[model samples]
Target: MGSAAADALLPLDASRFAAESCAVVDFLEVYYRDIESYPVWPDAEPGHLRTLLPDMPPEDGESVDVILEDVRRHIIPGLTHWQSPNFFAYYPMNASTAGFAGQMLSTGLNVLPFMWAASPAATELEGVVVDWMARLVGLPECFLFSGGGGGVLHGSTCEAVVCTLAAARDRALSNLGHEAILRLVVYASDQSHYTFQKGARIVGIPPSNFRVIPTLAGSAYGLTADSVHEAVKADVADGLVPLYLCTTVGTTGLGAVDPVRDLGEVARQYGMWLHIDAAYAGSALICPEFKDYIDGAELADSVSMNPHKWFLTNMNCCCLWVVSPALLTSALSSNPEYLNNVGGEGAAEVVNYKDWQIALSHPFRAMKLWLVLRRYGVAGMRAYIRRHVDMAKWFETMLEADERFEVVVPRRFSLVTFRLRPRHEGRDDMEALNRKLLVAINGSGRAFMTHFVVDNKFVIRMVVGAAMTEMRHVQDAWELVQDKAKEVQATP
Candidate 1:
């Protein structure tokens, strides 16, 4: 440890990093400002990007200017602009500058905070922010850390479903014996997201054990208690246990909300676990007015929402709350001695987030949560959500008033499902006709929408909540839709 040797410190040259970062920042600013000019969806067929780019990675490093230019020239054309105001297809993947800032900062830090001891500030702040969100959604105390329940942020609603379903699976198996796993059933409405069935597959639930109950337009496409009860009763009569019931607060295709209290009673009847998956519409619950959609959440063993989808957070953040953390921790915790914290079991209340999900490693997701909450405040979030819902209703009204069109299910949350009505009594090709109308509407380039089949009706879905969406965009979309519908009708 000679003074001379120690005095020779490492050189700190960061000019390249500074230049590249500045270039990226400038490009982002310009891209966001001029995004509306870009087509919301690409017209390119498959293999466009692959055919245009090099066959393999280059041996030499590319210049920053060259890379940035390539991004603008090649990457830009191939991408769908989800952030565009006129992009109303599927659901809004709303993101804000504040959330982007959090993402950038988190990536720079690049620390793995998978446990309290790994990065205490990140872990604790995650808990605090998640609790803040729980309150925002009007969740019961049982879903909070203070009431023996806690939250963890997963990358997607799919991951949340898988983790919670896995927890319920293990718990039910423990009590009923693992052999009975083949006979245990899971229940969800036909309109629910397809992720539940995917989860069932991942968790090894038998295909025969799933009950995808039919939902009708009369019930607004939601699963009813009676349907669930009859399914459970039939299974019980055959000596099968009803293991889990997933009631949605805003289903994917229809935005239909199941009767949570009624379904909860059905779950309770057979001692089954009730989990709520509100990936798309759960963010609306931040507004007190929308809280009725989740009236019986207290009876739920778990609940999840995608902040990335509607809460103005970017991709890769779904907050899942479990009433009893032990269920998941006990099922998924596989921390070896090497991965253990210094203080072991004595450190009781500390959360090792690694035990909560399938993956042991995760990004600093809480940063986005903290920043979004701080920047907008709950009031701003509520207004954002309400505005989208209002716009959806406006579009629904426009459809209902027109003689050529019909509102399919009334706007549920920020999604309006409607279609062009059949022109004649004997002509029942509305599905094919509406399909052409969708293509024309999207081809116009001013707006984009999606569709789904419910009760054999071809319903177009116009979902609001793009970052810059407003009344003008909604009205323009409606007008274009009406014009295109007429052209579609006149075609054949």
Candidate 2:
């Protein structure tokens, strides 16, 4: 009976298995080929995916046929399809065929790059790629290993901020006992990403010690040097030690850029470690026009940006560079006798990336980035970035042309923050009306957009960076917004 059962299972031979694999590939090919043309939002309701999946797992091992069937039936419909050209909502999480193929190859290899000895090639490749990126972005040589500083890839800007904060904290506490430092303060503009505050909290800085420097309206929404100086002076007067100042190149809510050169001077005056969070707009630095935003960035102790955000790479590729590796290593370095290896014998030597961030295990994510840079040369990347910037400018022009819509913030990078005017003069309910308009627009399912509340005013944000998005797509998106607003206004 056992022999018969084994024989029965073996009936589906290698040829049949190969045919099934081909079928899956063909299905994916067709799916992806038309993905760009798909609607940004599905017509289906929320519970659609949950209803299709089984409530519980199977007790026995299932055949490939069953697994594939569920994948086709349940999983495909639930996806939001970020790659679609119609996706003009949040900053585009772009991906390319080269990047996907590189990730696939890396997944197949499945190498653990925990230590230099574990995967030498993976480690070296990461180092080379980061250096290449730093050079491409016009980062100072001081931020590269060749100039005594080095970089490591983290999963997000949050992780980067936390790691840099930890390093700054450790450096501040080195002279005095950690307990002696009662009030360690950090400074950031009100426009800075909330992650900066989250990072400060995780690093043990009290809420009272987090200084939110106010940003003036119509003043570029960046953290001013004078505000930082005053905050640090007040903290010092209160016997608090100023430790970190996070300056953003492109704030999340609006693409507001902080004054790096001026902020660097203030940080130096206060003996604070300065970090530049350029998670969204840093990729544009590849284009020379945007490089000035980060001028005097050499003075920054550390800087971080997300390649996954706008560099045509897949998700979770944040590049962090530090002016001093010693600080980072001192903060997070660990050594155990069991884990000791011959490769770590020397003093000035190979790097163990585990000391860089909050995690021990990391995927071979560098492969995708390497593939992106190689496949799309620096010139190609610049061209792509310029195209989006130009589109954003065009959108700004259209918004300015409309008397009903007012651009709340100046166009910075590729994000345009604007909102509709009041329906009638002195109408106190304009914010509500605008909010309703945004809801109707997003709910239409033809296009997706998001809103940001700045200075207590509701403003819709039009972010244009979907990898395959063209001029026509932008035009269609604007048309949808206008039509949706009209529809909302026409309703009771």
TM-score for candidate 2: 0.93
Worst 10 residues of 2 by lDDT: 3-12
Tell me which residue pairs clash in candidate 1.
none
lDDT of 2 by residue, 80-177 (tens): 77887777677889888777767766776778676787788898788898999899888999999899999998889999999999999989998767
Please provide, for model 1 over 206-257, each residue's C-alpha lDDT reduced to its tens digit, 9 standing for 90 to 100.
9889989998878988899999999899999999888889999988888899
The superposed Cα distance between candidate 1 and the true structure at residue 256, in angstroms, equals 0.2
Best-matching candidate per lDDT: 1
Off by over 4 Å in 2: 1-25, 36-38, 42-48, 63-69
TM-scores, all models, native as reference: 0.96, 0.93
lDDT, residue 112, model 2: 65
Q: What is the Cα-based lDDT of residue 83 in candidate 1?
A: 91
